[model samples]
Target: MKPEAHYNTGPNELYLDVRLLQNLSGTAKWGKVLAVLGFILSGFILVFGLFMQQMLQSPGRAERVADVGLSGFTIVVYAFVALVYFFPSLYLYNFASGMQQGVQERSRQKVGKAIGKLRVLFKFLVIMLLLFLVLFAISLVMLGTGLSDFSLQ
Candidate 1:
């Protein structure tokens, strides 16, 4: 049997450029800082939401129940907004950490994991943007119809 020819695969191995690594490292640090801030903001929003709910339930505030109810709705909205801000921050932080580790260790797997997290972050943002666009379009349509009705009266 003929011996198999040895093929050189070393040149095909992926290597991150020095400049790219430097850029990624800087970005990772910034992402970590932003993630920490996002967590703090989310915590505050949660606390404020709970406080609003508690105030609404207090006995002496019965006369302002309607206003309190509006506040309750506002709390829910804020909580959702906080969550929306939070999840992306978490993904961004993870990506940053992973990328930093990958660079330090020169591990392709770690870098791939970091890229995955970044992909998730981008996907979430895109979905949110699409949702907002749809809602804006619906609101515009509603406003136009209402205006038309008013003009006919």
Candidate 2:
């Protein structure tokens, strides 16, 4: 069969342009950065919680494991952080799929298209930032109160 026919026909005759693909790549880049940031922040929070729990439970001991309170905090922090990671990852996947569609539609791209893409990417990034800030604030409040099903101490 024909190569073009195989790659761009029947079940896969997706139509897209270079400008659109560039925009998608820009958005995907933002998504990747956000995903990485969320993962890193989550890791940091988990480690911090572990350390704090160790300190709280171990005045003289040296073993390091989270206490019940800190463990609860870690779980909550991780859950939200996981969510932070999930959205960007989902966006990235959608963006990449869309970009592939654009590629099949148009064989070439340009700088202007890339720049236009950057605009939406930045907007999405800002939204993610706002989300992070709000969640972080909530986490801080929870931490201040201490994570517990019931206060034993």
Candidate 3:
């Protein structure tokens, strides 16, 4: 008699193989660490940006405008870079869950899916990063021109 393969049917009956689950757990841990770091860095950028804007808006603050603007731009760029990975990492997490369930159920469809999905996910991440870079460049240009207040009397 041929043995029946265990398959994870759906959410209610999801199962995960021990080895695969371990691997996924490890992957998730690293990903989570990255997410936390990104969040922290983004927070710093936001706070610094606020401070810069405050300084720029204050009377006689124009004296320091050049340095503050440069620093603010750097912070915004860093935040944008951090955010670039946000959505794609979220997708990767979903894929990891799917993979875990597949392994547990020994589902034929789940076994090799994560590998392909990761490639696609990474591609999307890179594209997002590129988009952020372009937007950042635009922001720098706009800020440079709008804040240019050199006066000659």
lDDT tens readout by residue for model 3, 80-138: 65466455655566566656555566555664575567677788978877987999999
Clashes per prediction?
A: 0, 1, 3
Regions more than 4 Å wrong, model 1 = 1-14, 51-68
* Higher-TM-score candidate of 2 and 3: 3
Candidate 3 lDDT score relative to the true structure: 0.63
Instruction: Find the 10 residues in a row with the least total lDDT in model 1.
Output: 4-13
- Which ranges in model 2 have alpha carbons more than 4 Å from their true place? 1-9, 60-153
| Candidate 2 lDDT tens digits, 60-122 | 433343433453565566566655655544444454444544454542343234334545556
Q: Weakest 10 consecutive residues, lDDT, candidate 2?
A: 107-116
Estimate the overall C-alpha local distance difference test score of candidate 1: 0.81
Question: Which scores higher on TM-score, 1 or 3?
Answer: 1
All candidates: TM-score: 0.77, 0.41, 0.47
User: lDDT (CA) for every model shown?
Assistant: 0.81, 0.56, 0.63
| Residue 19 lDDT, candidate 2, scale 0-100 | 81
Model 1 pairs in collision: none
Assess the local accuracy of residue 34 in candidate 1 as a C-alpha lDDT between 0 and 100.
87
- Superior candidate under lDDT, 1 versus 2: 1
